[model samples]
Target: MNTLTSSAHLVNVDIELEAAVLGVVLQTPGKAADLLRYIQKPTIFYHSLHQHIYEAIADLYAQGNDCDLMAVRQWLKSHGHDTTNLFNIISQNIFFDLAPKCLILFELAVKRYLGQYGERITRMASDPTTDALQLLERVDGDIDNIMGSIQSMKRPSVNDHLKVFLNGLDGKAKNNGPFTGLSTGIRTLDEQTNGLKPGCLYILAAGTGVGKTAIAGHIVKHQILEVGNAVGFCTLEMKGSEILSRFVAAETGYSNYELDRGKGIDPYKINDAVTRLSDKPLYIWDKPIELIQLEYQASEWKRRYGIKLLVIDYLQLVKHSMVKNRYERVSEISLTFKEMAQELDIAVLALAQLNRDHDKREGWKKRPKLSDLRESGQIEQDSDGVMMLFRPHKFGLNYADSSIIITPQTLEIHIPKWRNGMPTDEDYPLLAYYDAPTNRVGSVPFPDVPF
Candidate 1:
């Protein structure tokens, strides 16, 4: 159309254009055809003239200016737009499409433009309601489209993939329950915790050198070797190969120290560990700084390789990009990890460093309390269960003295909080062995320890 005809037609078209724009701005449907035509030309006025109009409106909004049509015309002229045509156009062209949405958007742009009576008009339109079930069905349809696109774009979240995962887990749990669970492998520990649940956050907390890492490694080996569950072992402090070597040493009954020292153990034990790992569904990631990278990696394993359980060697070393304060940072990491567990639908077992307060106390009893977790109290709060690894000998007690300490090589699997079950004494004092050389854990009973 010619410029003159378009300008003259502006009066006839203004209402529809305004209504269509307002509808789009308000995220309303049923006016798509109108908007499609209007936005066909994003720049009808010269880009410079359009630029001036936008800036003037923005300035009025910012300064809380209550400029009338004449003032707005003057402001436009001052800003160098050809005001002669624009002034005549804007002043006489009826604002035909000024719907409830347009009015509200305009009021937000220039509050002073909405006079005293405009408040009542806004409230009336704003309070308009719709059918609840219809709205829900519409929303559900929209969400289905969105989630479908998401699943297509990347991997399905574990929760989304859970039924398939659970089918696998159910079959394994049924078949392996005979070989592994409350009565088998390690009896005392299993009674309290049961075997680790998928999509769970298990925090194994303890002071340094208290067999936490060893115990975690042991759990991984047991689950991988005995139960046949796929494992993802992530360690921040130790190299993946180092952690694997420990697991291998533990599995093959070779002293890790002998291997490290190039001493007496048969090389066949190391070969056995390697051969076993190659065949098992166990993946290890030693690099621990990137949380998103870790999630991305875990997602790959879950999607491509069927990784069932995720084990992070410890929590404090797990980093985040957003947080500044160490304590608050840890809280965010803790929540993310918990969500990761739920999202992946795989059990996440994280090791955490307990506070030194446990060590400073008298009488050499060093059972870690929930409050003693370092960095964040949220660790205790977010965890499905808190398991503490307590070693009396680590506190300088005689590894042989069962009478004074009760259990030397035992882990106090204290379920300070169990969301799903209760903690009984039979479940506590889960037997643990700290193989110093290979750092392998065993289901060694506390009372059965040589100490």
Candidate 2:
């Protein structure tokens, strides 16, 4: 009966609300499976009796038994839960508004957990041996553990998604041009990848100073302003201000040089860029973050801003809470990115670094291969698409071998691995315009596809 005064604010758990939700579940056995997915555990119920009731219902449903009144009652009796309490639940006339009530129950359960967590922290703080800074970090982690449980994902049959897939296809044909998923504003990329779609993890890999962050900046701007979708960008390599400056440069067609030195810069254009971006739905985290912390913040970003996409600056930089084996850590990071993309129902665009192995290769093999992905094993396995950027210009090498003249500003995007669609021919990678001064990565209709 403890009251929680936290942001989620649960005054107390109501026994009646528990009974009401159970009533709804018992009346429809098929829906009980779904309810279990959403609520997760039966511990959401306040009283022990109510918890037992939910457990019995779930147990019966799992065994292919109908969760009707008589069946549930018999199971409860067999399991030793009082049948008299079942009548109290069955008598509840509330059938509608089950979702909201379940949410409330879930909130109460969260508060209960927080209360316990706070007590543990209190006991630790009481001891002088507990480091204050460590304790503070523990609090942050504890909160993430509690709040992260709010989102529950269920595995649905492929048939369940058939209508959605068809509708999406129809919408793309009628609404957007060849982009069934979230568009990148780069028509070539969108046309190729079908836009950064849900349930997909896209890895944009390149060597150092190869314009990964610059391209990512362009993408988020496109997603937020042009596509009218919110985006979250977390950078482990750069500062928040640096990302913003890149955004401003992309916005105003000013180079990073002009923006930084303020030489021959038009203040009004910068002002205009700021004005346009001020209200746009974009979240940025500049500093390095652990995998858990990034997930925590990403979850909050999704809840508050409804971000359709989350861009992690570079994969290798994502840390584990403690230092672990580099390969194992990166592997874990890669798989987590994929899971986060699926669980949050958002597109994950993770920028990654290519390994030195590519540099050791001769000829066109010098361009990154799927194997060149740093910790390539899991990254290649987990990503729905892997795009490797090769800038021969960056390495003082030119595409003199190709029919088209390669300038220093040219960008070669080699999509070596893809699941949603096959990549373009190996020799003919997607060409893009890299305006270093403006900090923008622009793409045109790529004509170099194998017939």
lDDT of 1 by residue, 174-210 (tens): 8845332212134556765666676778788878877
lDDT of 2 by residue, 1-451 (tens): 3221122343566776777788787776545644664565778877777788788876765444567888888887888777765666656666664556677888888888778878988999999999999999988987776666654532457885897688877877787356678887666777677778887899999988888887788788888888889999998888888888888887787778888898898888789989988988999888767676676677768767888999998888887744589999998888889988987789999999887887787766788788778778888899998888878775666565666767776888888877868697778888887777777667753333110
The candidate that wins on TM-score is: 2
Which predicted model would earn the best lDDT? 2
- Candidate 2 lands at a TM-score of 0.66
Off by over 4 Å in 1: 1-185, 396-410, 424-428, 438-440, 444-451
lDDT for position 60 in model 2: 67
Each candidate structure's count of clashing pairs = 10, 1
Model 1 TM-score (2 dp) = 0.58
**TM-score of every model versus the real structure:** 0.58, 0.66
Worst 10 residues of 1 by lDDT: 32-41
